[model samples]
Target: MLWVKAFHILFVVSWFSGLFYLPRIFVNLALEKESVSRERLLLMARKLYRFMMMLSVPAVLLGAWLLWLQYGGSGSFKMPGWMHAKLTLVILAIGYSHACGAILKKFERGANTRSHTWYRWFNEVPVLMLLAIIILVVVKPF
Candidate 1:
């Protein structure tokens, strides 16, 4: 279980590295006017998204494993309010990740209508999510 928790932390950190970076790429992508620069940014965004998604799979699986270990399965598990809130925030974070992928596609197709300002705000979503998640887990303030 200790090993599981450690690996979960490792993979979560890996996923977060992408969550922190890909949006900055979007900000640069939005600002880039040169074809060469745009193409490079697109390539970086695509690779980072793929790598981050790979990390997320392990993170999610390990996290679920920990949860199951903590609470057991099915009706045996009783969730605290803090855990519920943490999960809701996690769902929001996943939605944001999907939104980033969609936005990345729009950038790739040169169909982006959003300004760099939009992406700058968009970049803050994960930061807020991370903060809330950490607080929920550490404080468990229900």
Candidate 2:
């Protein structure tokens, strides 16, 4: 269980690293005016999005594993309110990741219409999610 917990933490952190940076790349992509630079930024965003997907899969699976263990592998245990809240945030984070992919697709198709400032604000979402998740896990605030 400890090993699973450790790896869950590892994968979550790894996944969040990409979540934190990918939007910053979007900000640059929004700001870039030169065709060459735009293409470069798009390439970076594509690769990072793929890598984020890779990290997120294991993070989510390991999280589900932890939840299963919490249930004593029999769905007989009662989870605290905080765990439910954390799961909500996790789902939102996954949605946010998918949103990023959609935004990347828009950028790829030359259909992006948002400003760099918008993306800058978007970049803070994962930071806030991370904070809330950590608080829920550590403080277990119900």
RMSD of each: 1.1, 0.9
Which clashing pairs does model 1 show?
none
Off by over 4 Å in 1: 73-75
> Hey, what RMSD does candidate 1 come out at?
1.1
lDDT of each: 0.91, 0.95
Tens digits of per-residue lDDT for model 2, 1-142: 8999999999999999999999999999999989999998999999999999999999999988888887757758788899989989999999999999999999999999999999999999999999999999999978
- Candidate 1's displacement at residue 122, Å, is 0.6
Ten contiguous residues minimizing lDDT sum, candidate 1: 70-79
In model 2, the runs with Cα more than 4 Å from the true position are: 72-74
Q: Which prediction has the highest TM-score against the true structure?
A: 2
